[model samples]
Target chain A: DAGVTQSPTHLIKTRGQQVTLRCSPKSGHDTVSWYQQALGQGPQFIFQYYEEEERQRGNFPDRFSGHQFPNYSSELNVNALLLGDSALYLCASSKLGLAGTSEQYFGPGTRLTVT
Target chain B: DQQVKQNSPSLSVQEGRISILNCDYTNSMFDYFLWYKKYPAEGPTFLISISSIKDKNEDGRFTVFLNKSAKHLSLHIVPSQPGDSAVYFCAALAPTLYNFNKFYFGSGTKLNVKP
Candidate 1:
């Protein structure tokens, strides 16, 4: 079965510019979450989408937003990006009530380079 | 503030030796702890995890230990190999009313297994 997949392996944007990254959930998964991993740091939660609605969000600013389609794919949009926004954007997928509740499979992150 | 912390930025060990990676969390409400292995240009791969109710979980040569009272967790790899060298991340799941899988991650610890 296919695992989680993300698009735009790499990207470059300037300050105040916007960028969009896409993610496809793993087969048989219905939940999608996004994370940001800065250099030398671990992944920080951005938000989570379930049933086409945002269910949870992290401490990130309003500039970061996301959506989940009916097919369980997701899109992370960062508006007015800053240099600090440069990081590896990670997408994870899991299903509710799965045998392992905390089992989240991740995709190869999209590296965002903001200049 | 970062709720999860892996104070050791790097670790090195000889092959066939025990490797212990530690993590501490400030949040007492964290219900689950997980360890992930990551390589350059890739997202984190789930390694092992332990729930708040459990003290330990083991799979083959990998084992995870949780100390709820101390708000700490640890990952142990036996007979480390060169291929095991990678950035290891610790993530904590703190679910809220709206989200069940939001995870907070640490800064990560880089493990280098020398052959």
Candidate 2:
């Protein structure tokens, strides 16, 4: 079984530009969560998608958005990105059952460099 | 403020020695805790986790001890191997009605197991 997979291992964008990264969750997973990790920092929760709807979000601004498809894949779109937006974008997959275990598997992450 | 924090930025230990990494959280609502290890250019790999109700959880080579009153947790790696040399992050999980995967991560501690 394949684990979580992300595309565009490395990306470069100019200030004010937009970028969209893709993620495919592991087999048999349903929920997807996006996170951002800056230099020398742990991953911060950006938002979470479940059943094709955004169920929860973190302290990030409106510029950060995400979508989940029926296939359990996800897309993270960042608009009008700033230099500070440059970070490693991580996608995590988990299963939420009646009694959730709250365990997650993460993708390799996409390194975004906004200049 | 950071809900989870790992004070030590880096730790160096000789091979076969035990490695103890500590983490603290300010949020009392965190009922579940986890530890993740990340190698360069890769996403975090889930190591082990413990629920707030349990004081300790042990796996083959990794053990996690949680002190609920102190709001502190620690990961102990016995007879560490060189492959364990990576950045270890401490994460806390608090489920809400909106999102069941509310994970808060610490800055991380880089472990260097010297041979």
Candidate 3:
């Protein structure tokens, strides 16, 4: 079975530009979540998508948004990118009902570099 | 504010020894905790987890301990091997009314098991 997969292993962008990263959840998974990991730091939650709607979001600004397709794939879009936005964007997938034991499997994050 | 904190940034231990990584959280509502291992250029992989109802959970050589009162959790790896050397992250899940189980992670701790 295929695990969670992410597109564009690495990206380079300039200030005030926009970038889109894609994610394919693990087989049999439905929920998709996005996270940002800076160098030498753990990931911080960006938001989560379930049933094609954004269910929850973190402290990030409005410049960050995402969408989930019917097939459980997801896309994270960041507009007006800043140097601080340069980090590893990670995608994680899990089932919905298993609330108590919600085990999330992650993908090989997309590294975004804003110059 | 960083809800989850891993004070130790790095640790080195001899092979075959017990490696203990600690994590503390400020949110009392966090009930489910997880530990993940990550290598360079790869997303974190789930290692083990423990819920608030259980103080300890074990799987093979990996174990996780949760202290609800103190809002602290820990991951223990027994007989640490060279292959076990990687960055370890601690995550806490908080349930909200929206039914979105969001995860907050700590500043990872890098472990080096010396042979």
By DockQ, who's the top model here? 3
- Which TM-score values does chain B get in all models? 0.96, 0.97, 0.96
Ranking by lDDT: 3, 2, 1
lDDT of 3 by residue, B4-92 (tens): 99999999999999999999999998878888899988889988888788999999999998888888888899989999999999988
Which residue pairs clash in candidate 3?
none
- Name the regions of candidate 3 deviating beyond 4 angstroms: A99-102
Interface RMSD of the candidates, in order: 2.5, 2.7, 1.8
How far residue A107's Cα lies from its native spot in candidate 1, in Å, is 0.7
What is the TM-score of each predicted model, taking all chains together? 0.95, 0.96, 0.97
Residue A61 accuracy (lDDT) in model 2: 98
Q: What does the i-RMS of model 2 come to? A: 2.7
The DockQ-derived docking category for candidate 2 is medium
A34-81 in candidate 1: lDDT tens per residue? Answer: 999888899998998889998888899999999999899999999998
Q: What is the lDDT of residue B69 in candidate 3?
A: 85
lDDT (10s digit) by residue, model 3, range A1-115: 7799999999999999999999999988899999999988899999999999999889999999999999999999999999999999999998886533646889999999999
